[model samples]
Target: MRVEQIYTGCLAQGAYYIVSNGEAAIIDPLREVKPYIELLEKDGVKLKYIFETHFHADFVSGHIDLSAETGAPIIYGPNAAPEFDCIVAEDNQVFELGAVKIKVLHTPGHTMESTTYLLIDENGKDHAIFSGDTLFLGDVGRPDLAQKAASMTQEQLAGHLYDSLMTKIMPLADDVIVYPAHGAGSACGKNMMKETVDTLGNQKKVNYALNQPNKEAFVAAVTDGLLPPPAYFGANVAMNKKGYRNVDEVINQGMTALSPEEFETAAESTGALILDTRSNGEFAKEFIPQSVNIGINGDFAPWVGAMIGDVNQPLLLITDKGMEEEVVIRLSRVGFDNVLGYLKGGIEAWKTAGKETDQVDRISAEEFKERLKVGESVVYDVRKESEYEAEHVEEAYSRPLASINDWIKDINPKEHFFVHCAGGYRSMIAASILQARGYRNFTEIEGGFKAIAETGVPKTDFVCQSKVMKA
Candidate 1:
């Protein structure tokens, strides 16, 4: 038996490719099916089963397309009662893909339809479970997803999750490896770990959620104000229930290169978002002020997603040629097909074309300090509430990026908008978000709040060399 973990990185989702003998099965497939196809073929396996632990609320799954193209049977938890190419899996139902034994456990906490796939390895001695959302390495799925499609309440879901983790997941052998459907930065769960996989025993010892003494505490821990799963949750669930359309096989699917003027014109007309996937410092130096800064560095997809909650709009990208395919593929995996195209030749193309550019205005720490001495510049720090309370620029008004939509509700949109994140990536994102809302006088800290400290600029609210909670 062979098992492969596919991390979509968009929403930090984990999909699995499992095969035994010459048959293969996919669990929690992302929309881009090419990777799965490649893996199965490499293993000399035929795609026979496509199982979703539940109807995903985060990103659209490729199950529909995979099923349509491969003539594979689509499987979901019994409660999904889904209409197409259907197989409703039941608890304890055993199946096989050659020498491996597969068992399904109905664990409906994250959603009414969530399930865990327990697999007995080819040797019949090895045991592993795909604990899909119901259990995680350190945390569990967010309890708030059941707003309406739920047959379960928050308490009910949390209770179910607690039972699933303790009763079903915990009973597996100590050495049995555990694979989850999500990792950190996913709104599906509050405190997901970064590890793609973990052993049941390691989780039993180190996982905070699993370590809780009772069901109530576990439920309380996992359910507490877990950030709302992306605004796209409802759309994704509906797409999954009805079944995904075969996007890759859909005709005329290749992306085009967009000229500066053509792209800018499209932006003006259709309100497309221009994403600059350069480093935070590079973006702050000068960029089309209209662009959102989501660097091509660490944790690209989720951060890009954190900035833009809506994928329905066209994504016009500005990046080095090296990152074009990556950016496109990441978005495609998450079902972000609204990408109109990428810049024909990145920012240099616009420069060569002599097209006008806009820059997000920035102020150095010293310069800002000097201005504030006589009150010329009012620094509005755009960090999270938790970050603000811990330590921040003395006079800066705090409005977190998470709450930016409602930031200007109290202050008029015409008010000076000076936004800053730790290193300016988020501030640039915030500034352009304001730009989109017709706020003209927006400025961002050049190197972010950290730039001031690092550059020997004046700062009154000095962080006292203590570790901060990584929120």
Candidate 2:
């Protein structure tokens, strides 16, 4: 028997592939299906089932598309009512996968239909549990995301999560490997470990959610400090439940490569937003005017979901030459399938075609420090609330990039502001959005707060302990 965790860094999501005796089962797949199909063909195994832990909110799952392509039935845990055809397996039901068995543990807290799949090897010993968002290495899934759908408060869901962990999961064997759906960078859980796989024994010892003394305590701990989920999350969940455009069709439609003239024409005709997926540093040097940059190298998909605000916002991409397809695929992963095309020769072609380009003013940390010393610049700390509370510039205003839309209204576009994130990635994203929205008088700190902290610029560790706890 072979079990593989296919981890996608951008989403910090994991999809599992389990194979035994020419049969295969996939767990919580991403939107793209060709890779899984190729793996199945290469292994000489048929896809027997597509197991969904829950209707995902971060990225559209490939279950519907994969099932349609491979004739594999989609499986969900009890209480799931997807609009499409699926088998809603009862708690403790077992499904055979050639020489092995997979048992469904209806651990519903992350969502009403959230489940963990226990894999019993051919020897009939429990080997691993694909503990979806129900359990992570150092944390449990945040209970707030599914509140509207479940008609339950986050505290109530946390109660259910506590029960699910204690009754359904904690009783598993010490040596059983725990494979979770997401890792540290995911918004699905707070304080997840960087490691994707861990032994159940280790988790019991280290995971805070697993060690809670009582149900009330567990609910309080799990429901604490959850930032509002990204704007596109609800839409992605709906697409997952009701089915969406075939990924192949989406890819075909988005992979069109338009020359500079053609790309400009399409933008003028369609009113599509230009998304430049180049790195933050390179993007700061040159880019299409009005293009928003969310570097493909960082938390690309989640930031795209958070900043774009609309799942179906039409887009035209300006990508590095070889990364066009990757840009398209990652956009599709987050249900952004209306990408018109990529700029064929990239930003260089735009320059050659005499099209206007804009550059974000990025100053070195030293320059920023000098400016601040002169008492001429207003600084904006665009990192999260916690990061700001931990340690920040002595006078910078907190304007987290995640909720930029709301806070942006408070800033006067006419005044100059210096923006920075933990590093440069998020600051550029904020800069791009500001640029697109006609806020031009801003300079992004080249290395963000990481570099600023090193320059000995006046800093403070003013922890608003109570306010931090409330956030």
**For this target, which candidate reaches the highest lDDT against the unseen true structure?**
2
The Cα RMSD in angstroms, rounded to one decimal, for candidate 1 relative to the true structure is 3.4
Model 2, position 125: C-alpha lDDT score: 100
Give the range of the ten consecutive residues with the poorest summed lDDT in model 2. 462-471
Tens digit per residue, CA lDDT, model 1, 274-383: 88888766765666757877777745665555567675767788887767777776666555667777788888888888876766677775665555542444667776
- Tens digit per residue, CA lDDT, model 2, 39-78: 9999999999999999899999999989989999999999
How many pairs of residues in model 2 come into backbone collision? 0
Give the TM-score comparing model 1 with the true structure, all chains together.
0.87
Model 1, residue 311: C-alpha shift (Å): 3.3
> If scored against the real structure, what TM-score would every candidate get?
0.87, 0.96
Taken over the whole model, the C-alpha lDDT of each candidate is: 0.73, 0.91
Question: What's every prediction's RMSD, in angstroms?
Answer: 3.4, 2.0
Off-target runs (Cα >4 Å) in candidate 2 are: 374-376, 461-471
